[model samples]
Target chain A: MFFFALIVKPLVLFILGLNKRGQNNLPVKGPAIIAANHNSHLDTLVLMSLFPIAKIHKIRPVAAADYFLRSGFMKWFSTYCIDIIPLDRKNRVNKKALFAECHKALDNGDILILFPEGSRGTPEQMSQLKKGVFHLVKDRDDTQVTPVVLRGLGRALPKGTALFVPFNCDVVIGQPVPAQEKADDFIKLLASRYDNLFQYCVTHQEPEQ
Target chain B: MFNIPQNSLYTMLLVLLFLCIGTITRLVLKAKFPQKDYTELRQRIQSWWWMVAILFFALVFSKTTAIILFALISYLALKEFLSIVPSRPADRRVIFWAYIIIPFQYYWAATSWYGMFIIFIPVYVFLFLPMRMVLVGETKGFIRSAGVLHWAIMLTVFCLSHIAYLLVLEDKNPQAGPIGLVLFLVIMTQLNDVSQYIWGKLFGKHKIIPKVSPNKTWEGFLGGLVTITILSGLVAPILTPLGFAYGLLAGLIISSSGFIGDVVISSVKRDLQIKDSGSLIPGHGGILDRMDSMMFTAPLFFHFLYYVKY
Candidate 1:
């Protein structure tokens, strides 16, 4: 089960180096947020595999409901094995039920993986973070927020492309930023934190050059 | 005749001593330095204990079995090294040479070709590796390409083969053989590492070139050297052909060389701006982290055994 994928995933990516960093920041306990910058769909697998899923609670990734949730098998795999929480990007205001589902998951002390950018953007700069993360954490002050930056996954498998590039993926997990005042400012800080985290992972990365 | 069973027991005792010291140091650090998550430290101690257990079992096992296991270890360590450091597509042929040539260097020792094992990687492979790369003729990343491949060969293949070469040392008694010698070298080298780390943590004040390895200290070097020196003298008669005095001196040499090795690899990671080389080993960072002490210690200890025993 868990051991199968753990062995297979790394075995498959053994040649690529799968260079990961900052896994120490993952809390050994519950109600943790993996606030990451999304680049490509493979970003899901990158973070999921990088973190010790065996030790930590199953991660509920907030993937795009409109895109990934469309297919029956994709939804099931993303929800169960990959454990993604797909959210609709088109109807943000109308997506109250999705927000409730995320809140309930976090309330039960389960791990929530959020792509704060709401949608995948160009590889360079992160976009404005949607309010879901802030709204979810505004009440539960004890939850830990981790800014994760997935730098290479996009290039490895970019948007609207089926090709899986063999480039190395770096997963940088920044130090936990606990819940605080100024919701908008905190979101900005989280985004900036991801930016800094990404820089550190890339700069500290073993350059094949 | 030097008693094989006694030497085996002695090795086990030393391994236990090191394990206790490492574990205690970690516990003390957790109590004293409450700020840091000493989990990594604890994990390191645990891994070392497992490593010691493995080594102990390997030594007690038949000579052929021990050599075979060591060969497997060298393969794994080298594989981990090659995975992290990128090689050019053109250098793929050299890599073939690297994987194929390296195991034979150890195989030479296993088959008791002492002379050939000693200089196989340095003299022959060193010469041939460059020529093979030259023939492939991917001149685009000439410096980067050749440099990394060369480094991979030197660190992974050349340095590591010395572990296997330890099998060739003959003693007055068959029981007091190369197995004890190989086990001794590894034990002493790793002990030096643990001693230095503990000493550094306890009394380390001077940075000892802070930028290179921030955690290392002059205090640790002195403490580790003195401790390993004494242990070396005590264990020398049982393990090596060297007298107690030379064994002590070898311990001192190996410890200091091991420090330099750690620093040299530290500098490599520093140049790359990486913290740990890789996370293949849970507690230990990467192959480089595990092999840092081995790089310098292997060559130094190998030659020492070569001159005295051969």
Candidate 2:
């Protein structure tokens, strides 16, 4: 974890010229959730590289079972290296298994990263956050949610292309929103917060003074 | 094709020692202040290794290889600068031409054509780029656009090419080898920056230009200039044909000129509200951030050598 995060990932991000902003907003020790906007394949790499070892090892991003767990290599990668929770995004998305997986990770006191957009979207402002993420935390009061917005992944490595253009990946991390009572209300809060972060990213083109 | 100069080898050994000391210091500091994050410190140490490795290879390789290496650096730096600045879609064609000019600029240096190499970016590209932009028929912010593109080319290509053009310097003076001159200029300029940072942290009280670069201070600037000048004064004779006095003058000139370049680039990034130029180099911001000081030092050092030793 230390070698990959500290040595390898930074070298890769340095080559691609990824700038991770507002990473300090992430909990140093996890047992929390990182709910971010997803658009590019670079998202997972961005998230993995942003945090140092302690928090990084604890982060298990919720990846689509179909895409991430399908291939044998990806299956081995997801299970061993990335340590993602396999989420069936197809018809009848094993909601129970998803909940059990989230609860299992949270119960073990690990941070779970989720893309509430569910599937990758252009996320011009933000795609509508799905209900599963809201449900994952709504019933649980212990898990803290950090609303994150990842900008520039589209430009860095767009959906259709493998070639990566050099650009800054701005991570706008909002204040941790404690779980709300109603799932819809919680989803709304997350969506609006994600939207606000997106706005801040676009308007604050200049770097922090 | 080359034998590493005594000065360059000495400089490399010194750099290795400095990096080892720096890494040890960071590790000790991290142990002392376990709560504070040393990610930047760690990045700095790693980048120094990368820089040293690159310098070793660039010099060890033939002069042609060194010229090509710098040309690639110029391309990367130019691209990074252009990507950050805003431009219309219509400027795309002219921007393509901007990239094309990079190889041509290096070609002149490779061929040792000093006349065209010196004037290509400033004279030819300066007029041609704006004319090309005008040919695109986009008049909105034309002056601003043209000025930005030309400025980018001049700094990223023209000034940086001077480092590669060091290869051609030996054509005039056998005593001033390309490897030694390059090593001296680069190591001296970088040391100037590092010394400024150290001085600023240790003795910096009053900000020099708080509005443009809040981190810069009077103590840092003056202390760094003295340190770099003295160091360069000692090292220059081993690398070039200059006596001690001229070496000191070169040191002072490089430090003072390097400061201007640093401040100017800082202002640009500040205007753009960016902390670093890019995230290409760890601890350093971008290729621009790493090369900004060179923009001032390379040309000055090149011309100074051309007039005196060459």
Candidate 3:
């Protein structure tokens, strides 16, 4: 925990040159969930880097079981260094069981990184959001679910691409929407927040002059 | 020059001192505000340890090693500054050229080509960057984009190159060599910032310029100036060729101009409506945020010593 949080994390983020905003909006302590728009594989790195160095270890990003857990070394790296919550992307996703794992994490008072859009894609393109995040926190009043939208990450490392574009990525944090009962409304509200956050990043681009 | 082993011992002692101060502060803060958060103070101390270690090792090695180390720092500073400024699609090629020229700029200093190193960026590259941009035919932001790119080159590469150039100076003082000049400039400039912050919080009544920088106060400015000037005079005898009087003058110059650089960067951030250039360091905003004062102080002190040495 000390080695990864202290040394390895800062070095990786330094090389990537990530530009993040609204980090203060992150709840200092979280029994909460972060629902972000995933772009490149770089999205997870950028998202975690924005966390306060001390509390960064508390974040357990939901990683695909097939990809991250394939090899022994990677399994060790992901589990120990990254501390990801291994959740497979497959048919049905076992809503009741999935809810249990995430609920346990939230119950233990940790932040879980969930890409409600379900998979990585280009920035600013909103995909249909899943209701896993909503279900995890629906009845839990003590938990907070914040919307985080990432821009420029797709250009940084696009889907189905191995090379980096060396772009400056921006992250915007949105206000936590009240968790409503219906999955349909919560997903709809999450999608709109992603759009608003993305719009804010684009419109606020600095002038060269 | 002082014996290399003795110098290393002294530097390690300085590092130990910094560690002590940081640990004591952390403990005191924790005791005083047990309920409040000390995340920032902890991160800051953590960063300071790495920074001191990096620099101590750099100085402990040969001159070539120090030059390479500073070039990397300049590269990081340039990358952070350029990333924040808006750019046109056409400016991409020119930006690449800017990165390419970083190694070139250091190469000149590494080989001690003073004549060309001083003017290449300001004269040749300055002209070349805009000409390259104009060739791209992006009329929307041709002039503005060219100006910003040119300024980034000057600030990040040209200004920082002076530290490398200090190493190239002819050996005239055995008591204090070029590396000492580099250390003195860095240490005094940094101490100026610390004292000002401390003094400002203690005795800052009248704001120097509320519009440009609200925290800068006459009390803080003068307090830092006088304290650092005296300290510079005290340290300069063993650190640089400049004796007490010149060192005092150099300290005054550093504190004042470094203030301008700090405020100017602040205004630029204010105009852009952004805070703290980037997040490279925890508790400290970014590379640019940390280097703002050093960027200004390096070149000024370099030239000041250059003229004095010649």
Query: What's the C-alpha lDDT at position A206 in model 2?
Result: 20
Q: Which pairs clash in the backbone of model 1? A: A65-A87
Q: What is the C-alpha local distance difference test score of candidate 1?
A: 0.72
Interface alpha-carbon RMSD, every candidate: 6.2, 5.6, 4.2
Predicted candidate 3 versus true structure: per-residue lDDT over A21-136, tens digit per residue:
57777766779888888777877777777776788778889888888899999999888878888886673556776566677887888898989888874443567788778777
Model 1 agreement with the true structure over A98-134: per-residue lDDT tens digits: 5777778877877888888877876434678877787
Ranking by TM-score: 3, 2, 1
| DockQ of candidate 2, scored on C-alphas against the true complex (2 decimals) | 0.13
Give the DockQ of candidate 3.
0.20
Off by more than 4 A, model 2: A1-15, A21-148, A153-166, A171-184, A195-209, B25-39, B87-97, B131-139, B171-176, B198-207
User: Worst ten-residue run, lDDT, model 3 chain A?
Assistant: A200-209
Residue range B233-306, candidate 2, lDDT tens digits: 88887876777898999999899999999999989887877667666687876788888999999999889878
**Over the stretch B1-310, how does candidate 3's per-residue lDDT look in tens digits?**
5356443356457857979888898999899989999998888888877787787678667888888888988888877776667765456667778878989999999999998999999999998887887787778977788888888889989998898888888855565566677778888888888899999999999998998788999999999999998988887777777889988989888988788778878887887777777776888877777888888998998889888877
Put down candidate 1 lDDT per residue, B60-113, tens digits, no spaces.
666666776766566555655554454454555566567677568767878888
Q: Give the local distance difference test score of model 2.
A: 0.78
